[model samples]
Target chain A: MKKRYLAGAAIAAAAALALAGCAGTAGGGSSSSTKTLTLAEAQKATSADDFGGMDGLVAAANAEGHLNVITLPPSWANYGQIIQGFEKKYPKIKINSANPDGSSADEVAAAKAQKGQSTAPDVFDIGTAVMNQNLDLFAPYKVQSWNDIPADYKDADGLWYYDYTGLMSVGYDTKKFPNGVKKIDDLLGSDFKNSVAIKGDPTQANEAASAVYMAALQSGGSADDIQPGIDFFQKLKQSGNFLSTLPTQATVASGETPVVIQWSFNNVAWGPAAGSAGNPNWKTVVLPGAGLGSYYNQTINADAPNPAAARLWEEYIYTPAVQNLYLAAGAYPAQLAAMEKAKTVDAATLSKVGAAPKDFVQLTADQATKAASLLSAKWAAAVG
Target chain B: MTALASNHGAGATPRRRGARPPRRPGTGWIGLIPFSVYAILFLGIPAVLAIASGFFTSAGAFTISNFSAFGDPVILKDLVGSLGLSAASAILGAVIGALVCYAMLGMNPDGWLRTIVDSASSVLAQFGGVMLAFAFIATVGNQGLIIVIAKQLFGDSALSSPIYTVPGLTLVYLYFEIPLMVLTFMPALEALKPAWGEAVATLGGSRWTYWRQVGFPILAPAFFGCMILLFANAFSSFATAAALISQGGIWPLDIQRALTSETVVGHENEAGVIALGMIVVMVVLMSAYGVLQRRAARWGS
Candidate 1:
């Protein structure tokens, strides 16, 4: 009796394992069928193309019922509010956001790696250089408010458009440097010894590259030439003023990195938080005469799992209400100028973001590509 | 011959001389099926893919330029840097760990102190990466606890030095390397027989002479083997260095850049080539280790 029971148990276990394997294969097979919406139909659609205009797009998106977004940290540009607001507005569509803290490179990598799968990202928030390099991966779909986006910020083919801009600024602990660094040239002073830090490798990080570009502009170099910036950093390293470290809030508060060169959005968001942590004198200053602005672009995946939902997301982000949400988070929305002109922007939010600098220069895609390659080839050796 | 003799003595028995016994069902070679499947799925396939990709371009065309990039000065510098760091840490860990093992040998092996030390060494040998980096930062970073204490006591910036530089990284690498050394080198230390010491003494050899001749020669192979392991461990380490160093210029860091950099074209194959280079280095060291371990095994048998 005992032997018979053991034999039966073994057979049952084997059957269960076989069933589990079959279930996994079946589950994987079903995901491909879930992509009922087509990329071609979505790309061609405008307000004129559809009967209900934006409402029809929303209806079509609701039918699709899901969106896969990637590399959106909640804290980044107030993505938390944007995502929450989006979901609350469109209760029918569920957003499956992957890798909240992942980098721009990670977003590109995921789109490439998971090309045909349901888990593939439908939207990307990436740097301009990265977006330009992987142009083939993005689909051409102009949002309803496409004309409002600046001419310099959008692709000619409607593949990608700028979402928000971050101006390069210096964030410093005021307790350490009572005089404060108001300009890029001020960083070279004797008071900032072994204190200054950039965000990360300029070759990889967009903010760090922009910081270098801002430094170049201040030190008599054009956007076409980043050599002066590299030279400046080398000089700083030679003078024992530049720390080859990535700065964080903790590092700034601890005096390990008393001064940091990063995006205005990041500095503005984190400066007050760092001050509240212990030091109450943290401040961020936009360098005078060096107001360089770089924007992160948004693109829909060419092979997005939910085509209608992805288009809907792009449409939602370009609206005046959402643009104000970005402004409130310390980022200059790509549609800020247009919204202000239309008197659609929230006055309170605009006042809080402060006045836009008149001479802020945006890099062309070609210039950005060239500068990125230059930095990749030269930054390491120059800094070291 | 014995079976044949037994058969002969039995006379007229049906059992034939030198005939094999019946094998058990579901045993013998069949037992290795699961392990073979595992090896093929995990190790064999990935290694084959890594090598195959190294010889191919991103467009699937064959190219040798991937391997050719190994000769580039920047790549060569990174490779040398990795080698130097690994060698320095491994040699330092091995020497210090051997000393520690010798000290442990003098203690009662079954004691609570021995038990605690052994357990701690095992746990610490596996400790590294992000947590270890954060731990060091909290304890010895620019505004770390020790630094703050030093500043208060001495009125000088004694320990305010940056802990993210190359030398600092070497110190971090040693945190696990020394304990790993203790774990790997202890058995070899225990393998040293007290009888050999007595024999050397009986032969009128001094303790110093015994150690220089018999002791050093016997332990040399195992020491070298452990050092090679430590070297491979340090060479292939990624997370600790990645977490600490922001601007990566080391071998693993360069490999990371090649694999992940958006601006650099044709780096996918280069990443495979760099990986292949690391495998070659590790294989060479492990081959040396295999030979030494085999030699050491002779003494055990």
Candidate 2:
């Protein structure tokens, strides 16, 4: 028995050493390929709600001198964009940033583990579901533009608020949506049945979850009742038109999946980029309809070790000029006035990517949860 | 074997009473302390936490709800699916490994066969996760090397398909498992002497007679042991499945199911339940083999 145990121990040690070595050598984001936000992409805020309380927060945070913000992306896409512009504006603070994988529950657990310590993130760009789950960890503060956000979106206690959303912009082979259908009903036609695609793992995504929430709302059930959402996938499955997974960019332009339920910016980035050779055939199709979008939000960590840097980053990312950088990069910005002023979210881009006016299916926390569960199960069944 | 126990006094007392050879002093045992320490830290602590947590949280009451969640069809299906795949991989691995071992044994020891087995086993052992995925894709994808070659040979209809299906997943797994199997079972084969086969053959015995009397009796325990190891390795793995699924996260779907569960509270239960069963099964098989090995030694003496 001792000999056997010893043998198992030896095997385990050798394996652990190999795994540790492999892990160190691969996949970690220490390269120039790592994404960072810059001041050049920082758009200025125009809506009165955005700049409202930022100055005080920035001043408070700056007195501390150093800031460490650990948040997830879309915000990571340009946390530095509008942020460093503020650093240029202030010149008193130093910042460190870490963008953990958004889909990892472990990363969220790690942040919870470090909540009160110096290592805790000063800001959290959390998902809708988790933002509410860890609300207690944050130190709540209402920003200047707090009122511009709907009461339902921001925490009344001011722990966190909506920063931006990754709505499902309908993408189609412009070759197929020739007249360019711009509504949810537009997707039901024969031309787009098997052609539409969805990201495979919707359970981990805020946007995908929100889409199901939208479907429940649009089809007459409250978001709290997600039977409609389940039925939605079931119908798609029975129709034999369900293409459940779409690669981020490669599949979109290839016309394999003509319509993709994807982020606005991914479509914006690749919509009509110089194709691999001459020009790719497909184009983007943005549809405006009820229950067709998901919002990826940014929220400040209330108990930030570096509240100044967190606040500074908040102000930096909310500006119009910087917001346009995101627009240019392929994401829709939260600050509408800034985007309008910059005139970068072009009509062509909007037609290809933005949600149509009057189609928002706003949901509360309880409703979002119920919708997430029902839709995820139906999605599993659908994929199966 | 049953008749032998009645005659235990023949060799049993002498063996039991005789002064056993002192274990080779410092025969690699001291080199194992770090390994023991690691097992306690990683395998021991996590297992303890999991079992303890299943009973009660640090703060309060006990709950059997984690086990109850297995009532869900999805959970049960994942458990069964994982077992099925692991068993399949293990059997597949053992067969391929045995065949390769037999083939290599017949060849000259210093020949090309040895070189091929050496390099191939090492390379296949290292092939995992994304690199494994890429290798399969390069073989069977729409734009893969084989598909292109086949298209020129056959036609465009060949590209209109999925080479990454469930069958394809099993094939990819076999690619690695067969090599690892070779790595695991090769030592026993190397230890085997040609004299055993020739001696039995000299008595005018047929091949099957020799194998039954000499080959399998000697190597059956080793091959079976290695098969169980293969099953355990593949069963516990998450990454290869994660990479292979069609934009999906993991195969057996259990790993992804575990990851996406809102509460981690019940995850260990479902995964641990299947894993714990595999461990129990493996322990039983190995124990039985150990007993058989003792019986075989007694018979040989």
Candidate 3:
């Protein structure tokens, strides 16, 4: 009888704790009593219109008090400043950024694994390839500046939208190639023997895939057909100029891989990082006539535990101030066209990054998917 | 031969009957609860889930088509490459580790040298993944320290560097494999009783004759079992090779490519199929190891 009493008491205590958890997530702070929209309503909000206006949305989000973000490395494209800028603009909310070095796929997996929990990521910044495959996982929330975004750069329903992109460029040790590589085919020369490398396997990584697509453009293959890119790599390998090593700052500094093909922003960023590491004379060049650009997409997790804060974060990042941060890091923002037209872009930062390539190609969703499949089918055979 | 046969018979029967009491059936199983729970949670459930996913399509419909990944020439090549690498590393590791064990046979167990070797083996066997890959890169990579020295002595063409290739990977695998071999094969080496040598000498046998007739028979199973264990260790290893090789040159890397490819969708279940294949390979290897272990144990006691 005494054991049964203890068991019953334990069950009651567990039930109380469970209820407390639900209450904590749903409504905790004193300000939540004045919240116009419930957490459920905020989760379904497609725009601030659902909360009457942006001010109402702000109040609801402030009540929530916490936002969960994943896979946004602070160093990438000046996210560190953007995050700090958001915190300064919204002091009431605390942003929790987890797994800052995780990949796009890892972001999706974490969201799925932590679905309804308060710790679940409320937002995602993922590559377009992964974003296309996981449309159903995102909430269709349009920011207040949604109309300024290009029609082709976002989903019709605002499920996901382009954030920033960098032109695919070649970064090399200036000591090795004094004249600099003026064209993609320069990598095939004898001086570059066993020296050229991409960021990762083209079949898997976004940056490496973009590098191949850039090669495809130069080799007379369209975005829908990337076979020429494979042939180009095979030819380079045959000439003993293609290295399979994944190039990092350390490897570049050590001269293990003298030339790396990746994003212009990344390579430009590497000029400073690798200089500090050892090698001081690093240079990046966006080869003319073959500029390929790809953008990462941002979206709200459909099952966000802090839904109001997720929407508020969307509003925060899309602002002109935050978009200019991408320029400072040598990347072109999705709103570059709009900001240029409105004369709101940061001109000094834009000049430093140089002009966006006049004749660059950004593959549509369908084109990228087709290109990806082709790469998956043929990459290992071509370069294995 | 007659003396050895008599000794074996005398050693086997009476001890089997008298040494071990019949385990109390139900209560004795209580000790296995924690292990059983751990296995079920970590191993058994994940294995079942992974293998089951291989038989299903992405939309949850049942299908066997996912197994077709094995038929891909690329996958077949990866499998062959992985198996050959594992075999090479395992055989070399076993031989070198066995030699180390042989060298240590006459050492005092509590001596500083033996203690350091034992502790180092225990630590180095667990040292792998990114740290090991970085160490090798810093030591023998294209522009590494040894390569720089060699380049100065002999022209650049004298030595073809192998730091990022399969040969280099095999050499790296041996770093830990040799140590593991010492830790595992030492017991069987120590099990060689001094009395057995004395008995052989008394029977007018030479040292080589005693080894050929007795020592080889007793130690062969244990040696092969440890070699198989090392093979499994190399087979399942991923991070070290992944850190070194960018492309999918092995089974685990292939699985990594299938699952995490940013552009490839609807092929995630192929990772499960590949995992199932690995499990099948492990099951066969472990079964052989079990049989070898039982045989070795019989002789050991």
Candidate 4:
């Protein structure tokens, strides 16, 4: 009996050791395929380097046959339709979208964590503030339509470029607020008590951060200063109108969050969805005084697993067809001006977006970075 | 094992007649090889790296600024909040859970009701994080069923604070904490033999006196051990709170902020420092638990 027990213990221990050894060996394998075609060099490629045209680049991407995208919510900016169009265009290359509900910070963290792994994100759709913070993690690659993109929109080295932009707006349930919130100050009324909410933590989420910046703009702060925005939230909290919880469609329909400060595109898209989900009175309005617009950027991960496919994705997103999809979803596509000039934009889609406030102020990279830092340092104290 | 023990027993009888030789050192250590290897790979390496990073700069130079950053008032507030939340939840869970266990003791242990409650407690204790937070929100949130019903009945706002606040969070935590308490404290309750009660009854001692003298004394260490476990569990928990509260002004949230907050540049080391602080707290609590558990083991045996 003693010998049998000893043998059983030994076998279990040996099996565990064997499993550990197997796991170790498994991870160290699978990174040794030598490619005659390297995607890292594609960043510096001209027409000649890619066999003289866009056709050659397409062939290369098709050969690779895979793309890993992170943080592309299907509802946000009509990524669902854009992704479908891309897949339909590139039948050979498969797209693996990860964490559709994850925030911008989660995307950057995944890029950092999975740096050299085969599972690393090939493409990223994140806030410009996040893109600037993690610039070293991006590989410089300009699409074929790079010339049409505004100079202010794209990085000089082509590490990152604007995809679509949205204005910050206030959304409210029509039934709850019979007298609608037409301005930022209207949100401070006792009727809106404990009803105002943003998407998520401003320090981590771009939409919420932009909302704060818009509030700052409305409350005497310029593009460079965000203190007024924090103070605005503080006063809102003091007035018992601020709710720290993230406002989701469910929360909106449930009447828990009747007022939300979010991006115009999100508000526009979510309003109808919330209406369909039993809250028919959902309405959105862009605040005239707080006309601040922010754009999300597109970039290729520095160590993307499917580099060719990533570059192809970047090329595809900036095209007229995809840009129109963005516009139809209520976001102002980055290539809107170029498409308008070329008359390649779908007029019907342009009409659907209607008109947004034109007096919007754009933040420089430095100003955004400063504002993010100040908000991160002060937001908790202000709201708490 | 019996054959080896017999052989050893035979050898020891003769050895006992004279002087026993010192045992070989490696012989005793061989049994621990598997556990030691597992710990070194998983716990030991990560813990060492986390501690080392807390003392280093992003460029890998030695620095104490990471530790000093804890002096920030926000960070201090988070620490206090985390401690207060954990303590409140743990104490509440322990008292309520202990009462539940005592109630179970009066029921027939083999009955279907006891069996169902026992199984439910086991399952519920582990049911927390995102799903649990959402569950509470659906039940007691601003537009929750209970709130809606109460509003109709009273013709006014029934609950003053929303479910996302600290008080609301404590209420949500109690949902899991009470069940966890029942599961942990039930075994200690079961260890209380009927003979102890019978002996007190024969001695003409009242029920209250019997419990005061025998029941409470025997269960005290186990109760304390469970409370510490609950405290540590609540202190380290992040997902439930993260899902509920968007702006984290608590320790676990601060730790998450240290890791994921983009505004604070080079916060990875600061995260390591915060993580190290959490580890220190957990270690201290666990050590106390370990001592209490050992003390309780005597009564259990």
- Can you give the DockQ of every candidate in the order shown? 0.25, 0.15, 0.40, 0.30
Clashes of each: 0, 30, 0, 2
lDDT of the candidates, in the order given? 0.75, 0.54, 0.80, 0.76
- Give the poorly placed runs of model 1, Cα more than 4 Å off: A1-52, A253-255, A273-280, B1-36, B157-159, B263-266
Task: State in Å the error of residue A230, model 4.
Answer: 1.6
Best lDDT among the predictions, by candidate number: 3
- The order by descending TM-score is 3, 4, 1, 2
Model 1, span B1-301: residue lDDT tens: 1121112212211223465787767558888898688777766686678778889987689999888768766678778778888898889998998899999999999999888889998888878877888888888776678877887899864235556765567788888898888887788778788999999999999999999999888888778878877887888887777777777767888776666564443466787788888888877877787777666655542
- Per-residue CA lDDT of model 1 for A53-117, tens digit only, reads 66656666776566788868665677878999999999977787676755577678778877876
Say what the RMSD of model 3 is.
7.2
Supply the global lDDT for candidate 2.
0.54
Local accuracy of candidate 3 as per-residue lDDT tens digits, B193-258: 999999999999999989999998989988898888888888888878888888677888888877
Worst 10 residues of 4 chain B by lDDT: B6-15
Candidate 2 lDDT tens digits, A1-384: 122335534643554454345444322222242222221111122222332344444444454455555534333344445456556776766554443333434335445555654445666666566655555655555555555456755667666666555445666666656766565545556555555566545554555555455555555656567677556655665664555433445555444456666655555455555246211555554443454444455655555555545666656665555555555545555665434555644555455444334455556667666666555455655555
Candidate 4 regions with alpha-carbon error over 4 angstroms: A1-36, A43-51, A273-279, B1-49, B157-161
- What tens digits encode model 3's per-residue C-alpha lDDT throughout A1-384? 122334534643554455355555545443432447776777899998887688877877877777778867665787777888878888987787777756687678778766876667899989887877778899998999999999988889989898989999999999878978988888888778778889778877888888889899998988888888889998987887877777876787788888999888777777764347646878888888867998888899999988988999999888999889887778898999999999899998888789766668888879988888788778888887
Fnat (0 to 1) per candidate: 0.36, 0.06, 0.64, 0.46
Residue-level lDDT tens digits of model 4 in B1-301 = 1111112212211111245577776677888898688777766787788778889986679998999768877788788888988899999999999999889999999999899999998788778778887887787777778887887888875243466875567788888888878877788788888899999999999999899999889889888988887887788777788878887767778766666554444566787888788888887887787787777767764
Model 1 pairs whose backbones collide: none
Better of 1 and 3 by DockQ: 3
Enumerate residue pairs that collide in model 4: A1-B1, A2-B1
DockQ of 4: 0.30
Docking class of 3: acceptable
